[model samples]
Target: MISRDCLQQSSLMAYKNVYQLLGVAFIVGLASGRALKADEDASPRIGIIGGGIGGTSTAFFLRQLYGPKLTIDVFEAQKVGGRTSLIRVNGEDYEAGGTIIHKKNIIYEFQDKGMAFTTTEDMLRAMGDDLLNMTRHTMNESLQHIGLSQRFIDEFAAAAVKDNYGQTLNAHGFLGVVSLMAVEPDLWAIQDGNKRMAELLLRESKANLIKGSVNTVALIKDNLGTGSVSYELDYTKATPGSDKETSESREYDIVVVAAPLNEGSKNKISFADFPRDVVTFKQDYHKLISMFVQGKVNTTAFDVGSQNELPAEIISIAPGCFFNSLKKMTPVSPNSKPDTPLKPEEAVWRVFFNKDPTEEEINNLFVSHSDLRLVDWWAYPEYQAGADLPPFMLYDRLYYVNAVEAAASAMETALIGGRNVALLAYNQWHGHFDKIDEVQLPSPAENEETKKSEL
Candidate 1:
């Protein structure tokens, strides 16, 4: 009988070989003219737009399915971490986009393997029957079903929903509230930066990582009515705050849009002749601004004597507050060598807002370059009650990972959504698509549920 250690070692080695083969297969497939043919039978050419957790995880999971011989390409306008970015101030680094990662997210599957398991209870009992379907309900209405107090609902649950999703409980849907409740007790991040996780995912995938902004994606078909579908991606190397490069085009058997489908975003990519539903989803987006400041905070404003005595890691505000939330970050160690020198009293804090704060409002919180880092991100979808979210398969052979953002905008959701798409793509490619239209990717905490139930 095979030992557990041997099985684990073999799996690790298999994954390593898969990555190495994916790189080699991509180059070879390009040279061998692996184009859109109905029955040519060759390695598929996969294209992933947006180098965030969704896109990188798509590539990673694809490698596992197609092995080392899969041809995959990942395109990023700026860096790998779409919203998960890093900013340096006063010789310290802070997350500019995605800050905290929940252990229940799909990314931390290994750690969640030991969690206390819960079986699949009745959907009505867990989240109510109304939330089970696409029919949406506000968080207030849903929490009422659970018999929560008005004060607890207003202060704690509502505050967390607003801060985490950039929308109040009254404005968000039932799924949005579930997403907030899904946050694990322990949040995790890389020591240097949270964006490093995206970088690591890309490296593990062994995909042909290209740096460019995708302008348009068009579905190309054979004039003779062949059933095969191919995609043409037109992109340019011109990124914000970078020198512009010439526009280029490429063809792939499959295309996955990993970034948020917001028309107003800087990294927004247009789809030619896309479904009307997809267009509508792309246009509807939420507005969020992430600001990083280096200065002393008025603990008096927080009704606390010192930062250590804060009630939580974050201080979220209701509708009237100037900023959505203020998160205290770990300070840079003295041993750390940053390119810039630090001021003795400057502390790094990250603030989130639905709109830009006024000069007076900014000064009220942070005294002083100390308040410079600003990012106008379209963030996620403003999921309203009864609003419909499109499927991952936007079109044939074209997957949309950010569609899940309408329900939850966590990094775990992105990774899980991407993995589901990857599985779909793999199933179609190998003709094992029994569960083609299903979302089967388990979240980090759910991995142990099935096993514990069997016991």
Candidate 2:
């Protein structure tokens, strides 16, 4: 069996190699053939579907690559933060969706130059074979193979998956690793809410936030004999006052679908005049319910002597348990001071469940409550071991950001996916084929040798 340290070192080396190649690509500005017609007087127009982390981050990276001259439009029907959102409880806002972020997540490395110039496949390949092999097995098998004790896998590992994904050890190993990362030290979240990341990325990208849901993306042939192709998007925006939706259409040089194009997804943007189906697989998302209740702990139900005996968080492994986990929540605002010693009756708790809890079940979990709010989410992909991952490119000049969710779904992964799609688009537009789908990168030692040779 390979040592854990060896595996970590290998993954780190792989990441370094990939990033180094990307830096070189950005510096050289290599071009083989241009996909979009170059017009000095006209800047390329881009349309992005969804206003979530993936979409917003794609816009941000596109701005970084294409500069401020490009026009970008982001379409969102309801809110800017898609799955990362908030809910009100007892007149205070609390996170209802994605919460903690791992310290090692790439989100913190946003300041690194040339970090986003790679495809999803290339990025995953750079993580080394050991970590990539995790995608081919169940979490149970992968952890056991990695020399983790069964006791730890059953208790700690199970709890992590249950709490983060609302799934058991049967989940794919890659996502299980992602779940375990959540428990790592130095994990943090935004002061107000995680959704602020999306809002701020959108603002920084300077993209127009269109209030509507995109319905169709059709390939528009160049009837003017310019041999250039564009995509037309048809969307519907709610009328100002009355109960009506105004339909509108627009054309763009490139389009990025930042949301999932799966069976249960709300976005139903169809592809027209394409050579083949955009996405051939029948993918589905897992349903998770986040229930927030401001209430007292039912100590007796937990077999505890008193409320103080109960921990702030509870992870249940029993198959009969209706909920995955229960955790005490803090206010969204960092300025608000939570009462010390947290009076059991005054605390706000978030309970994750695969299904809605019955009134009796709720009563059994909590003694009393003043406010209760529930947010149902098609949270993530129904991950299956050995399942084929989706592609970053859907069609020429058309990309999908949520394809990375097939391996693991998290805020950081969403951002990574967004950056990848943006890079793929940029590379294809600028004819930088050398940077796309690169199979291997030179080792650090090789890079140093080449530098010495050049000197």
Candidate 3:
């Protein structure tokens, strides 16, 4: 039989080889582990847009590090927490964007900072109160076949787990790389990513949060005659298509734009206008329509095996060969489209599609005696190859912390974007680190003791 020690040793060796191949010789350790000079004396005003996971995490981390001394304010267009928000399908709350987390990640952060989490326990509770309860798989096939930025693949692939916020591009240099490999991804592949993200957001640090919309516009050159920032912010939504939502702008000593780059940071704040900031990337987003139905929607069998016993998580809203839950929805309530609208309990297994198909064809894919409901979400980035990506770069004051910036790859990207931008902003403000400094990664706490007490 295989031994755990041997497996760990093999994993480490593989990761080391990855680093060497990617030319990341500078990253000697897992994290940069650099200590930051406290910004107890400096304060900078900040502005923001988008209140997704990235933005929220950014806001959380910023407040954690600079709080009272640093006055930070945020403005979001819609609801807070962005894509990490929850959706109600059949009366149970499910993650509309990010849905999974890993245990090793929790160990990583705890070992580094002596921090613990309640959410991990909550997730574990949902999984039989055991970290090992989650299923694991190795994705050699996806990696072998997945397309990605050559530079990114080169850098990340060197690590044991190479992850890109769902970014890939064929290389003219390494074109025609065959897509054939055995896939057996373990739980760590996804969990570690999720685990680290949760730790960073719920940091032992304290943070302040504000919500609202920010209308960005164009900026004029500083014409020093009698005026300074020439273009005035459009604080009124009086016009038909004006973009600015309100006259709300708070002050912050330092603001790291966690979301995409909009015209606001460019000195354009429109009150009544249309959002015009667009990225050149092929960003496209899709609206998700989820329908939930239980109790076997149709007489035909949808799953590969019997439904006598199955994990609730298997009823996901994605496409899979065996555990596909999208098998057409059944209408349990007969109040009828003639009497009233459908309800959540009427649907059990939820399915999402980019476009709405008729109920006739959809009906053929379900088990009998099920319920149905629909939910629409502006899934990030729109579609593959960048169809709906907005300017996740609103200068350096805000971050488009949804799947849009990192693309709707996972909840981890949305969460990580927030932490990444906050660190970048903090480093720049303290003058201890540079935003582009490749090696200036977040340092592990000085030690477990120091980390625990710092909070």
Model 1, span 1-455: residue lDDT tens:
22233222111100011011122333233224321222334468999998998898778777755666778999998888888877776666666777565554332332112111011111111233345442366777777766777776766666676667777766544554554553534555555555656776677778998888899998776333333688899998765586757889999988888887776778678777543444544337778888877676655555457645643345353445556776655532324664555554455667788899887767666545354778888787777766655667777777887776666677777776776677667666666544333223466478688778889
List, residue by residue over 357-437, the lDDT tens digit for candidate 2: 888878877888877888889998887788877777776778888888887889888888887787777767666676565
Separately for all candidates shown, the number of backbone clashes (residues 3 or more apart, or on different chains) is: 2, 0, 94
Of candidates 3 and 1, the better by TM-score: 1
Per-prediction TM-score: 0.76, 0.84, 0.51
Which residue pairs in candidate 2 collide? none
Question: TM-score for model 1?
Answer: 0.76
lDDT of 2 at 41: 43
Q: Per-residue lDDT of 1-455 in model 3, one digit per residue for the tens?
A: 12233222221111111111112221122123333334666655544444555655666655555655655444455455555544444444434444333222232342123121112222222223222121111122233444555443443332212111111222111111111100112222222122233334433223444444445433433334422222222222223476644454343333344444332232233322213332333323334555544445332233335443322222221211111124322222212231233343234455545456456535554535444555555444322221232433333322334322322344444544555455555655555332222222233554566778988
